[model samples]
Target: MAVIGAAVDSETKQVFDAIARSRSVTTSRLAGALITDFIRAEKGGQVVTTKAPGLPAMGHAAAHAGAKTEQVYVRLEPYYYDELGRLAAQRRWYRSAYLANLLYAHVDRLPVLCHDEVNAVRQVARQLADIGRNVNQIARKVNIDPDRADLSAFDFELVRMLLDVETAAVKDLVHANLRTWGATDVQ
Candidate 1:
C-alpha cells in the first residue's frame, strides 16, 4: 500500500468527518469506498461528474470550526495513486477535493433529494405524525372513558386498516428512495 498524502480544505474535511461519524465508520474507510467507486465508474466508461447541488452543506458551525486545511493520508495500492492523479488532472480538480466530490456523489444509505422533494417529504411526514398523534389521543380517551368516548359510531378496524396501508406505502417509498440512490439491503 502506498500512502497518498493530500491536502483537503477545512470544509471538505469537516463534511467527510461528519459523515463518517454519522455512519460509525472511520474517514479512511469511507475514502477507500469512494475511491473504489470512482475507479469502477471510470473503468466502466461512465462520466463521473462531481457536481451535487442537492447535497446539504455542512452546518455554519462546522464550516467555521476547523483548521483552514488538513492533511489526509490514505494507504492505497500503488496503481490507485497513479489512477487518482490521472483522473484528478483530467477533471482539473484538486486531488483531495476530487476524492471528496466522489464521496459526496456516493454517500451510502443517504437519499439525495432535491429541495422541492425534501419539502414534499417533510410535509407528508408531518401529516403522518399528526395523524398518529390524533389516533393515540383518541385511543387514550376511549381507554380512559369508554362510555363517554362514543365508540359506537367509530370503526376501529377501519382506522387500523388505513394506518396499515399508509405505513406500508411509507415503507415502500423509503425503500424506493434508497434503491434510487444506489443503496441495497433496503429493509
Candidate 2:
C-alpha cells in the first residue's frame, strides 16, 4: 500500500472530519474512499457515491433473523473487487451485504424480497392471519355446540374473497421479487 498526503484549508479539513465522524470511520479511510472514487471517475469507471450505510434491502428470511456472529475474508483481484463494489453500489448496499445476499439466495436457495416486495408480502400474511382467526372462532363455536351451530351467519363467500385477494397478492409479490432479481422466467 502507498501513502498519499495533501494539505487542505481549515474549513475543508473540518468538513472531512465531520463526514468521517458521521460515517463512523477514520478520516484517513474516508479520504481513501474519496480518492478511490475520484480515480474511478477519472478512469471513466462508475463512481460510487457515499451513502449512509444500513441494512441491505433484502427481506429477512427466518434463518437470517439471528444476529450475525461470523465473519469471512477473501482476497480478490483489484478488477474483481471493483466490479463487486460497482454491483453493490447499484443496489445501494455494502459489498459484504450484497455478497451475503447472493450466497443466501443461490447457495441456500432462499427467496429474497426487496423493500416494497417485503411490505406486500407482509400485508398478505396479515390478511391470511385475520382469516385464520375468523376460521378458528367459527371452529370453536361449532366444537362448543355441535347441535345448534349456526353456519348461515358466517359469510363463506367473504372468506373465499379474502383468500383470493391474499393469494393474488402473494403471487404478485413472488413475481415482482423474481423480476427484481433478474429472473427471466418470472411468471
Candidate 3:
C-alpha cells in the first residue's frame, strides 16, 4: 500500500477528527469509507464527472426554486486555489459556487450525532473541565510549599491521587463519547 498526504484546513481536519473520535476509528479508516462510497456512487452512474487530460466542458445547473445563495470568502494555499479554479473551469462553474457546492456536498454526506449523543458529549466535557480545575488547585497548593520536607510525602500522595482521578475522568469521557461504537479499550 502507498501512503498519500494532503494539506487540509484545520477546521476540516477537526471535523473529520471529531467524527473519527466519536466512531472510535482512525482518520484513515474514515477517509477510506468516504472514498469507497464515492467510487461506488460513480460506478453506479450517480457521479457523472470524468477525469481526462483536458478540462470537462459541463455547465453548472440552475438553482432550485426559492433557493437563496450566500456569499462567503475563504483563503486557501495558492496551489489549492489554482486546482479549484481549474476544476471549476472544467465544469463551467464560477469558482465560488463550485467550492460552495463541494463543501455542502461533503458536509451533507457526513455522519451526524444524535441529540442524546450531543448532550452526553457536552456533559463529559463539563466533567473533564471540573476534574482539570480540581487538579490545578491541588498543584497550586503543592507548588507554594515545595521545600516543606515534613509535608512532602503528603503532597506527593495528594498529587498521585489527583493524577489518578484525572486519568480516570479522561478515560471515562472518551468511553462515553464513543460508546455508540461499542469499541473496546485498545490501550
Candidate 4:
C-alpha cells in the first residue's frame, strides 16, 4: 500500500468511488472495463448505461426459486399459520411440527424438534442407518411427550403439504444473480 503521492487527483477518485457505491456495481463483478467506458460516455446526457446490474435479479429469482437469497432473516414462514389451523382440527395433529423438525435437522444439524405444538413440518426424508430407524424416531426423541403422540396415525393431507413444501425447498438452493439485489424493493 505504497501511497507514493500520485499526480492523480484524490478528490476525483473519491467522487468516482461514491458513485460506484451508490450504484452497487463493482468493476470486479462487472464483465469488462465498464466503469472506464461509462465515464467516457458520460460527457453528455447519457440517460441509461449498460445493462442495469444489481439486486432485483437476486430477490426476484429468490422468490421464484423459493430460496433465501442471502441470510433469510424472515421471522418464520406464512405456512406456519396454516399449520397452526390444522392443529385445531377435529384432533390436534403434529404433522407440520414433525416435518419442520426434519428440515432443520438436515440443514442446521440441530437435533430434531419434538414439540407437538408448532407449525411447519420437517418434510425431509430420514437418513438413519438402522433397519427401521427413521426421522419419526428422531422426532419422537425430541418431542416433549413422544410415546403417546401416535405418529403412526398417518395424515394424507399433511403428507401432501410436506411434499409440496419440500419441492419448494429444493428450488431455494438455486442462487440468484447479484445485479438484482438492491432494486428488488423499489416496486
Rank by TM-score, descending? 2, 1, 3, 4
Off by over 4 Å in 3: 1-111, 149-187
lDDT of 3 at 84: 86
lDDT per residue as tens, model 3, 82-182: 98898677657778866765653333322123355456667766766776787677678769886752444445576567667756765665554334223
Candidate 2 colliding pairs: none
Q: Least accurate stretch of 10 residues (summed lDDT) in model 4? A: 174-183
Q: How far is candidate 4 from the true structure (C-alpha RMSD, Å)?
A: 19.2
Clashes within 3 Å, all models in order: 0, 0, 0, 19
Question: Candidate 1, residues 1-187: lDDT per residue as tens digits?
Answer: 8555569999999988876554445677656656765887878955322222222233212323353434568887889988888766755666675565455435534454434446667876786788789788889998999888887777778778777876776666667655644555765
Candidate lDDT scores, in order, read: 0.61, 0.69, 0.55, 0.40
> Which rank order by lDDT, best down to worst?
2, 1, 3, 4
> What is the number of residue pairs that collide in model 1?
0
The alpha-carbon lDDT assigned to residue 46 of candidate 1 equals: 53
Candidate 2 Cα outliers beyond 4 Å, as residue runs: 1-92, 99-110
In model 1, which regions exceed 4 Å deviation? 1-107, 185-187
What's the TM-score of every candidate structure? Answer: 0.40, 0.45, 0.28, 0.20
- Please, what are the lDDT tens digits per residue for candidate 2 over residues 6-104? 999999998777556544567887778778879989999886534313212123332344424367797989999999899778667889887776665
TM-score of 4: 0.20
Residue 144 local lDDT, model 4: 64
